[model samples]
Target: MEFRGLGFVPLFIALWCTAWVVVSYTLTVIYGHAPLLMYISQTGNYYPENITFKIGFLGMSNATLVLMLLQYNFILLHAEAFGARQPMIQRILLAMGITSCIGTAVMSVFETDFYPVTHRVGAFCAFACGCVYNLWQAILLYEVPGIRRAICHIRMVSSAMAFIGVITFIGCRVSVYTKLCTEDYEKIIEIISISTEWLMLLLILIQLVTCFQPMQHLSLTVSRKGYTICKRENQDSAV
Candidate 1:
């Protein structure tokens, strides 16, 4: 009857997907500024040159920040649930998830056209750290008795897909830079890279859905200390 933490899972996914769709549609259909096969970063580039750039930039940056907060909360929940079994592993997972989230935010904030080096670095951090985090989480879930076996298996498959997607994305991009392929081949590779990037994003979102069931019973609480500046001390404390 109570789905406390489950709402955030869908909310995060919806916001992310909505942002991508709105920005992509505006750029490709409304403005004709980019083709359908453009990479995710391309949608947000050329700030101040087009109104769509502002839409893409703000949408992605805010969405990624929301994702960052969601991931941080999820890591805290996992640590609370499973920290007793593998404290060090929990710490590592928390670090990796947060790093990936921050990387995503960085990439979203720094458009590829304006900040090429910084954007590439951010993309590398996001994908690489995110891949490790997903795989590690799958392994961690496997060792837990309370979690469903189906969820563990689903995470394993999704994580594997994400790994392949990352490899394909990076390989395609590298091939483009090498200039070893013909122009036609370069175009094909670029399309593949863009498709793989989207696929990887979907896989990551699916992985997040797995947390819903496990976190259904969990609820977040906020409290203020009696000694805080905004509040008076409790009568019991004075006594």
Candidate 2:
């Protein structure tokens, strides 16, 4: 059976992410101009609190990340329980969310100024997990029945964007790190990678938009204990 729509909660999670992007972008603008090749995290650092954006941005972002992760955790776990035949897929989704949350927190706290190497490690973890997370989500989006009719195309497009972004970032990293590209070329590649990152994020927001309406068709209820209890109803009633 396919799950058609995502519950209202996921939309809230997407909103948090949007907030993160806006705040971070605004902060970067307020500070002295940062080169495009520089990572977004770099924008959060080395400036006075009032003058810089990333400080407040990361703090708020971390909170949102935690909330988003927790929401996905519950969502996927419930999916696993009901979607028995594909337990592994559901489990992996949950794992990705948790790992991404950890990565976000680590990257948020360990700024380039205070912990350059650690910061990079956190960034790598977050990006890699986030990419894979989207990839898996794409699979589920296509395979799941209820929402697939409307979202299959969306999933394909969003996942494709995510993969393109991941691949470009990897290629740019290899070129920059190996000194295979000139400084100017490397900078340009880095900028392209950043653009792809934002593109992937935008796709996620789009995916959430599609998921919101269909959740109503799924007979998922929140019990008194605040747990998601998926009890599929008769087709007529669900509709």
Candidate 3:
């Protein structure tokens, strides 16, 4: 069955992603200027208490990431529980679960400055899984013999997201290793940091879009296959 209004799901996610961008820009305007100074002095020069801006910014960004992670988690769960008819989906679920776990651990390390390693590892795991899933879906779309056009569209979106994910993951690693905006490379670092944050927003947008695809697919499938709809609805609603 053809899915109608599926485009709206990704658009909605893009709208939600705007909030993170706003928060990030606000933080940049407020406290992102002299990160090196703050790092050295271990305090903000002006309105020291406003350091909350950075914390709040990070919190909002992390919250966005967590929301995306939860969405993947739900998809993985569904694949495991109800996708026995599609065994390839089971492998996707495993990849999603592994990446989600890594993402969760990296996200949980907000208490320390040493989260760089955790973040890099988590991003790598998630990026790898995204690439694998996208490639698998792309191949499946070609070989399945039906719904090739629709799956091809999904493949395009998934591959784009995978590319963005890998780039963002590598960017994070570069930011960590290079220590941008330090006394030595002050200007370069600032640009890199801001660019990293912007890239992060894109990654979040892609993840959210990817998450909503499954819901739209399920909705369309149920609408097309009425007999399976009842059983599918019962099973999906339980999730």
Candidate 4:
């Protein structure tokens, strides 16, 4: 069995998820229940697991995971074909990405209201490791010469922006914990933190969006009950 032209799968999934999340959060706010400045996963915490959690949150998390999986699959092949020396780093990044994805789904299932402790732990894993995933990929991209033409400056720039966002988020939490922030100050920090988080994710997805230029011909052929990158000749093969 073979799957050709599957490159856009991740890109489409990213776009769909991003739009859905914004729309879901917008609806939640518009309904006069959710507050003005909402966290990305805030809507998911609504009691009874509203449609936002079921479709928007779950759908976005899983879809992003699938997209990352696909992107990393391409990265592995791209590295192998290009002769990247550090296989260990790429493997670690891939593993961290996969783990974060699983954590995202798990966190979604156990909302913050229902299971605060467990959800916080899972969120930490998801976002913390998620940062590593993006940063590491950017590292590899910079170190590897073969993908320079395919991966433009946007990848590097976006990765840096995402890292800045993480730093801002952590800084906000630290300020609050140290009693350095007043109630109003904390609220302002939270809003900035939320915006940064969203921007980081949006940029990450945008990086994937541009990936179509180079890997749009990525072949996903089933082999030995797994998938392998097939050559152009196998483009039209069926199961």
TM-score of each: 0.75, 0.73, 0.47, 0.80
Which residues of candidate 1, in runs, are more than 4 Å off? 1-3, 6-10, 47-85, 226-239
TM-score pick, better of 2 and 4: 4
Q: What C-alpha RMSD separates each model from the true structure?
A: 7.7, 5.1, 8.8, 4.1
lDDT of 4 by residue, 1-239 (tens): 87666756767767776776777677768676568776766777664335656565567667767666666666666565545555666677778987787777777777777787787677777777887787767665554333445466777777777777777877886787687999878888878878876787687687776556445546778878777764344433311
Candidate 4 clashes between residue pairs 3 or more apart in a chain or in different chains: none
Candidate 1, clashing residue pairs?
none
Q: What are the lDDT scores of the predictions, listed in order?
A: 0.65, 0.60, 0.46, 0.68
Compare the candidates by lDDT and give the number of the best one: 4
Which of the numbered candidates is closest to the native, going by highest TM-score?
A: 4
Residues 60-165, candidate 2, lDDT per residue (tens digit)? 3454454445434434544633466565665666677667667766777777777988876776777678667766665665544455465667766776777677
Best-to-worst order by lDDT is 4, 1, 2, 3
What ranking emerges by TM-score with the best candidate at the front? 4, 1, 2, 3
lDDT of residue 223 for candidate 3: 48
TM-score of 3: 0.47
Tally clashing residue pairs in candidate 2.
6
